[model samples]
Target chain A: MSRLLESFRIALRGLVANKVRAALTMLGIIIGVAAVIALVSIGEGFSAYVSGELEGLGTRTLFVWTNRDAANPQQLTTADAEALADPLACPGIEAVAPAYQQGATATYAGIETSPNVSGVTPEYLTVQSYDMKVGRFIEQDDVDHRGRVAVLGSTPASDLFPGSAYPIGETIRLNDVPFEVIGVMAEKGSTGPMDNDDVVLIPLTTAQTRLFTVDTVRGDYVVSSINVLVQSEDMLDSTIEDVSAVLRERHRIQPGDTDDFQVRNPSDMVETVTGITTTLTIFLGAIAAISLLVGGIGIMNIMLVSVTERTREIGLRKAVGAGKSDILWQFLIEAVVMSLIGGLLGIGLGTAISQIAGSALDMQTVVSVNSVGLAFGFSAAVGVFFGIYPAMRAANLHPIDALRYE
Target chain B: MIEPVIDVRDLTKVYQMGEVEVHALRGVSMQVMPGEMVAIMGPSGSGKSTLMNMLGCLDTPTSGEYYLEGAAVSDLNDQGLTSIRRHKVGFVFQTYNLLSRTSALANVEIPLIYGGVPRRQRRQRAIEALEMVGLGDRLHHQPNELSGGEQQRVAVARSLASEPAIILADEPTGNLDTRSGKEVMAVFQQLNRERGITVILVTHDPDIARHAQRIIWVRDGLVERAEQVGDRILADDSQGSEEDKGQAVAVAALDASGTFEEVAS
Candidate 1:
């Protein structure tokens, strides 16, 4: 141990003697490690943020959207949503909310704007997790009575009402159909490409009768799609299977017939986004890895030069009782120290740079302990691996030939 | 039946240069008793350097038995040879071979460090060695900072610091002036006399060769003759050592200074 330590000190002295060369040698490793950290951190941050946002839509929620067959064009109805809520019929389903949507202008005291108006049942609040900012959402009674009451999304409420107008109890006109605003939705921000904040929600009966002029006696309550919430994430596939069976049965579709509805899960969305982020990280990481490879080669190059330059010294040491292994270790330790220091500096620099870039670009950046350790350990391994060739060359030199070197 | 400090019998060294074979040494047999002061004299390409390397354990003989202090060194492997070099022998080179940018004290400490001496003791012993060579004041000075003679003295101190049984000097004074050469010779004589160190010098100068008790003349891969010096340099007789001989001899092979004639008349 003492002998190794002595060699380490000697190696440090050798490096210290050539300051510029040592620093220049370390530069490659520094840049390589820094690039890896920055790219990896950004990628991880983006994936995490995206996954979090996707999870906010609820992992167990199955989206049954309209994949309308061009031949039939069979639209969904309130019966499909009601059929999915039966515990014995749909084993993995917890709740179902079918919605019919249309574009309509909401006007309240001269403040007017065209926003998406969604007609939904009371289960929409529990299934979609929409928090009430003020007043209450539409109840079962409102849907049954075909009451002319509406719920405003944050953006629509703000736009359709004057400053501090208290949207609750205020009467709003949707396509010239007057309705009292019973509640306003809490701000939920943007969901991917959709602006959920700029929407209006009302009873399905009201939308079917008062807005779309559909007859309840005919019972053809056309809905764009239904939101089916699964009981648990583990049973999401079975829930979709059960819902598909029920919907097919309810729509009176025969065997081998193509259904007009699609059952999708948020996990698929999460996978798509996470897949893109991972590919981007790996692509950038590969480029950074190439730089690391270049840095390793640089270390090898410098170590070779150092061995050649110190040939006589090597010979002298051998003559004075140092062994070949001793000489090999000396050079190896020098290379490792150079690369290790570079790795540490790169970690610091990369973290700082990524944080700065994250704030500047208004993107999330995460620096984990695992990433730092991985970079540091990899750089050291690079040092050892690259240092081996030059160290072997030094160790292979004969004492006599080396000593006699001019 | 005491064993010789250095023993070699029928020693031969052959170098293979592509398809050609160069014989550096041929059946060279010699022995030096313990505590003997000897010089091996030869011109360039005469196998003296090769023999010096063989004695120093830096190279293995092609064929022959070389026993040092009763151990068969010719049979030893590279690791064994390194052990021999580390503990049994010390070397002084013509160029000093000190690591540039390193302090003289640090340079001297290298041998002891390799020998596994503790750090504090290594420093103390290196200082003692430097002081012995009259360069105690220049311990921290780098090689480039020191004069040629001072640098040579530092090399000698390094060789002495190991406390080896035999000191092998290959042209120790070849790069110095006459005064520095004599000064180095004086230090060698002092160590040989007081500390009872066995010293072997490889030299081209006849005057420097006379400083040893005996000299071997080598020519064309063979020892031509062994000569005992009629007048040797006493350790305390630096002033009386410059006596001029009134004759001429074949000493033209070495550097000629218009001073004392120490060659055979």
Candidate 2:
């Protein structure tokens, strides 16, 4: 035990004697570890952000879309949505909202902006979990009577009426057709390609008859997509099966034939996003790990030089009765101490950088405990691995030859 | 008669340099009694350094019988040799060989550390060893902080810290001025005379060799002569004569006649 302590003291003194070299050697390890921590946090934060966005869209929700790649693609309509909404047809379904959408310019008092105009029924607000900032949403009476009433999402509301807090009861023209804005949606922010607040919602009847005027060969009104809300998370799979069966029957899809529609669970998108981000984190970490490998090589290089420089010292120690293992331990402990100190400093710098980036870039970054532990552990392993060769070289020197070294 | 502290018979050391085999030592036979101060004198390439290395247990002879403290150490492995060195052997070098930037006390403690001496005892023994060499006040001085003579004394203190049975010093004063050389030789002589520690000095300088009671002349890897010095000079330049002065003159005559076995007998 005392021998080991003496080795540590000797190693510390060795480092202190050449402070600039020691610090430079440790810099490689510090930068490598810091990069690993910072890049990994960025990747983790991005995945977290994606999951949060998915959560806001609701976990118990499923999207239904027409399979345009099918041999005989069928248009989705409000009738199909109403059929799926029947409690006996799809027992686990809580609500169904079929929406038809088109890009159109909305103008108010000579101010115009292009927004996604969606035609939806009263159930749309409930299915999408959107809240109103003012006035009321579309009612069943509005859909039945083809009322020219509208609800504006916060983006278009603010764009068309900047500085105006009360956008409700204002008359706006969509694609040159006039409609009254009865309500404005609360702000929900944007993510990726879809802007949740850049929209205007109107009654389906008015959209199908007045604006788009598109009718199928069988005289059925068409919609772009349908949003279905399950009663609970556990009922999602069975509810999808029920909805698929009902839709296949309505579209007259034959057995063994591909269906003309798709049912997508939002949770699957969350899993995909998580997988992509995790792989990205590993890739960035691997690149940073290359720098660590180089740092280990630097340690080995310096240790070899040290052994050569201290040849006479080693010989004198041997002459004074030190064994091979003692010499080995002294050099090995020196390398380990250096790398561990570097690991600690790197952790501090990494966390600080990540926190700075988190605030500077307006993105969330998480420096997890697991990552810090892994980085520190990896640096120590690097020390041991690289220190062995040089330590062995020092230990194996013939005492006579070492003593005679000039 | 008491057993000799160091006994070597026909020691041969061959060095394999690339393809040529260079013989460093050839059938060298010698012995030294306990508490004896001996000097092995040789020119460069005369194998005195190799002989010193063998005596110090830092290298093994190619083929020989070496009994140190009456134990045959000729065939011992590296571990056994290390243990023997730690317990029975000490070495001093021409360069002082003190660890640079280390305190004199710490330098002395190095051998004891390797010997696994307990911390408190190691410190106490190091201090005593330093004080023995009259470096009592210089215990905390580093090698650079000390004069050439003081550094050599510190090295001597280091060698004495483990209390080994024998010390092999290679040109103990090769790098020192005459006064510093005498000072270091004084410490060695004091240790040998007072502590009964056997000392072997290897040097090419006849003046340095004159300090030992016996001188073994080595040439061409062979023992050319082994004879007692007529008048040995103490480290303080005081001259003294041995009781075996008549026997030494006879040995010197036999060496002149090339009858080496008669001197050994």
Candidate 3:
């Protein structure tokens, strides 16, 4: 222990003797560690942003959209929407809503706006992941009675009624027909390329009959397409497959005939997002790891110079009875100390940069404690790995030659 | 009457630089008794430094036997040689090779540290060593802050800290001013006389060699002459008396500078 302490003192003295050189050497490691932390944090933030986008799409919602059959333009119907609600055939199916969308001009007072009008039942609130901010959404009674009541999404309501004192319970004319606004949806941001909070909703029957005015309704009346809400994420895939098979049978489509409907499971969205985030993390970690490599190389280069500069000292210590292991350990300790300091500095810089980026870019910057651990561990490992050659060179030096060195 | 502390028989050291084999020591034999102060003197390239290195166990002889206090040193491996150096021999360099950034106390304590001494004990011993060399107050002073004489004194103190049987100094006063050189030589004399530590100094200066009771002159890698001085500059009667009584004739002849001619005859 005394010998080790003496060695440490000697190593510190050697480093202190060349102040500018030592600081410059440490600079390489510092930059390397800082780069690792900053790059990895940025990558982490990007991944979180993507994952948050996927989460906004809803957890247990399954989307069924119309796949136009070129051969038969009139394909999906109300019967297909009703089949999804059957408890036996499609187990764990929570609720189903038939949706029909049409672009139309909405007018209130002097304002005129073209909004995408969606026709849906009360269950459409659950399937589309809409939450009411004021008033109520379409109820079962409204759907049964084919009421001409409407729900305004935050964007359309704000646009048409721009600071109006009354929005909910106020009547808005859709294509010259008056419909009472029953509810206004809360802000839902946006989902990738689509804005969910921009549309207006009314009962499916009212939208199909009053808005579009196609009596036979063709394939578009299957309420544009059925929205199947599953009870949980675990039942999603099977429910989607069951619904697809039933729809195929109902529409009498042959195998591989390009069905007149499309089945979309929400879990696929989650899985796709998870895969992307994992890849992003790995990619970011790899780029960050390059800094560690550069830092290790810096350590090696500095240690080599240290060994050369301390040749006479090594000789003197050996002449005074220090063994080869002693010389090796002294140089090794210097390298380790340099790297450890760099690692700590890197952690601090990385965390600060991540916080700044998180707020400035409006991204989720999650700095993992494990990443700190990994960074420190990597720094120490780099110290050891880079320290070896210099330590060996010091140890291998002959006391005679070392003593003779000027 | 006492067995020699160091025994060398037919020792030779050859240095090969590229193709030339320079014979530094060629079939030289000598003995140094315990507590004896000896000086080896020769001109440049006369192989005095080579002999000193071999005696200090810092280098191995190309051929011959060397025994330190009865243990054979010539056959010992590098680790064994280090142990011999740590426990049985200490060295002072001409340049006073104290670690540049270290304090005098730390420099002196290093040998003891390698000997596995505990920190407290090493500290105490280092202080005592420095005190003995008259530099106890300068313990915290680094080599750069110290005078050439003080630096050499610190090196001498380091040599004494390990309590080795012999201190091999290669031109201990070479880099110092005359006054400081004399001061350093005085410390070496004191260590030899009072502590009964053997001192073997290499020098070409007759004035520096005058401090030792016995002087060995080397030329062309061989011992040209060996002589004893009758009156050693020490208050310790034991070392002076023992050296005087045993080789009185040799000492008398060397005191007159006639011993070299007699040995050549």
Candidate 4:
């Protein structure tokens, strides 16, 4: 233990004697480690934000899409959504909020911009777990009466009514059709690509009867997709089977035919998206790890040079009684201490840069403790791996030859 | 009779530098008793340095039996030789091979550290060694911070710190001025007389060789003569010698008449 500590002291002295060279050598490891931690932390933060948002929407929820068979044009309707919501027909289903969306320009007092306009039922609020910032959402009576009322998300509401205090009583025109703003939703911010606040919601009956669709017929209607909530996470597989069966029956698909509709659990989507992101993180980290390899090579290069420069010192130590192993360990410790110092500094730098860049670029970055520990441990391993050859060279130096060295 | 501190019989060294082979030492045999101050004197390329290295255990002899304090060290492996060098032999180089950027105290502590001395004891021993060398106050000063003579003194202190049985110095005063050379020689004499430590120094200068009690003169890889240094002027040049009165008077008179060539001849 004392010898190890003495080695550390000697290593420190060696580094201090060649501060410029040591610092320059350590730069490689510093930058390599910093890149790894910074990039990985941002990746972790991004995934965390996404998964957290998904969890907010409930993991057991499933989205059913039509593949929107363009040739057949078999779009969904409110009747189909109601059919899936029936407990007797789809046993594991709890609620269904079917929605149709159109990208349109909304204007209020000449402030016009493109916003997503969604037509949904009263269960949309419960299914989405969204709360009103001010006024209430559209009620069942509004959907049944085909009321021309809309609930504006925070962004469109603020943009169209920048200075107005009473946006709930104002009228906002969606594609030249004016609708009274009945409520303003609380801001949900951005989750991945979807800006939750930059949207407007209206009743499905109003959207179908008045704003969009040529046919006014209610029985055979069209919607983009349906959001189904499973009764329980354990019941999800059976619920997907039940929902698929009901859809198959409603669409008149035979036993051998492949269904045109796509049924997906959000958690599966989470896994797929997060899987891609994780792979992307690993790919980027691997690229960053290449720099660490380069850094290790730098350490080896410097250590070799150091051994040559300190040849006489090694000889002197040997003359005094130092064994080959002692000489080897001396140089090896110098290499490790160099990189270990760099590794520690890199952790602090990487974390700081992560936080600063995160805020500056409006990105969410989380520095994982695991990545910090891993980067540090990996740097030490690099030191050992790279230091051996030079250490061996120092150890194997003949005392006579070394003493005779100028 | 007690075994000699250093016993070498027919030691030879062959140097193979790439394709060229050079025979540095053919066959040389010598011995020194305990508490002896012996100087091995030779000209450049006369193999005295090689002999010094072998005696110091820094290099193993190619063919011979070298018993250092009764241990056969010439046959020992590199590590075993290192252990011998560490525990039994101490070396003083011409350049005072002190570790640069290290304090005088630390430089003195090198051998003790290798000897597995505890930290507190190592410090204490180093302090005593430095104090013995008359650099008691310069303990914390690094080599660069000290003069050449002080550096050499620190080297002496380092050698003495281990309390080895034999001190093999290759041209100990080769790099010092006359005054510093005398001062360093005085310390060697002090260690030899006061502690009964065996000191073997290599030098080309007859003036430096006069400091030793005995001289082993080498030429062409063989000892030309092993002569007792008749009258040692080293302990104190100002005082008179009790032995070899006539020869000492003749040598001093030759020096006084400025015909010192006779002393060399």
TM-score of every candidate relative to the true structure: 0.90, 0.87, 0.86, 0.83
Best by TM-score: 1
By lDDT rank, best first, the candidates go 2, 1, 4, 3
Deviation (Å) of A381 in candidate 2: 1.0
Candidate 4 lDDT by residue in tens digits, A241-270: 998898889887778877778888878878
Query: For residues A136-206, what per-residue lDDT tens digits would candidate 2 score against the true structure?
Result: 99999999999999999999999998998788888999999999999998997764468889999999988
- The TM-score of candidate 4 is 0.83
Per-model clash counts, in order, read 0, 0, 1, 0
Model 1 CA deviation exceeding 4 Å by range: A68-73, A86-88, A159-166, A212-219, A249-259, B230-265
Error of 3 at A336 (Å): 1.1
For residues A1-406, could you state the per-residue lDDT of candidate 3 as single tens digits?
A: 7678777877777777777876777766666676667767777777667767767778788888777744664455666788878988898799998888888888988788888898888889888778998899999898778898999988889998888634877899999989999889998898766788889899888887777864454443546677888998888878878898888787777887776777776557667877877787778777778877887888899889778877888888888887887888899888887788788887888888888988899887877777778888888889889988899899889887899987
Query: What's the lDDT for residue A147 in model 1?
Result: 91
lDDT digits (tens) for residues A96-139 of candidate 1: 99888889888878878988998999998988888999989999
lDDT of 4 by residue, B1-265 (tens): 5567888777788899999977778777777778878888888898999999999888877897888888888788888988887888889999899988789999999888778789999999999999999999999999999988899999999999988988889998899998999899999988988888889999988998888877887777777666666443232322223435523432221222121111211
Candidate 4: pairs in clash: none
What DockQ number belongs to candidate 2?
A: 0.70
Which docking band does candidate 4 fall into? medium
Model 4's chain B yields a TM-score of: 0.87
DockQ of candidate 1 relative to the true structure: 0.68
DockQ of 4: 0.56
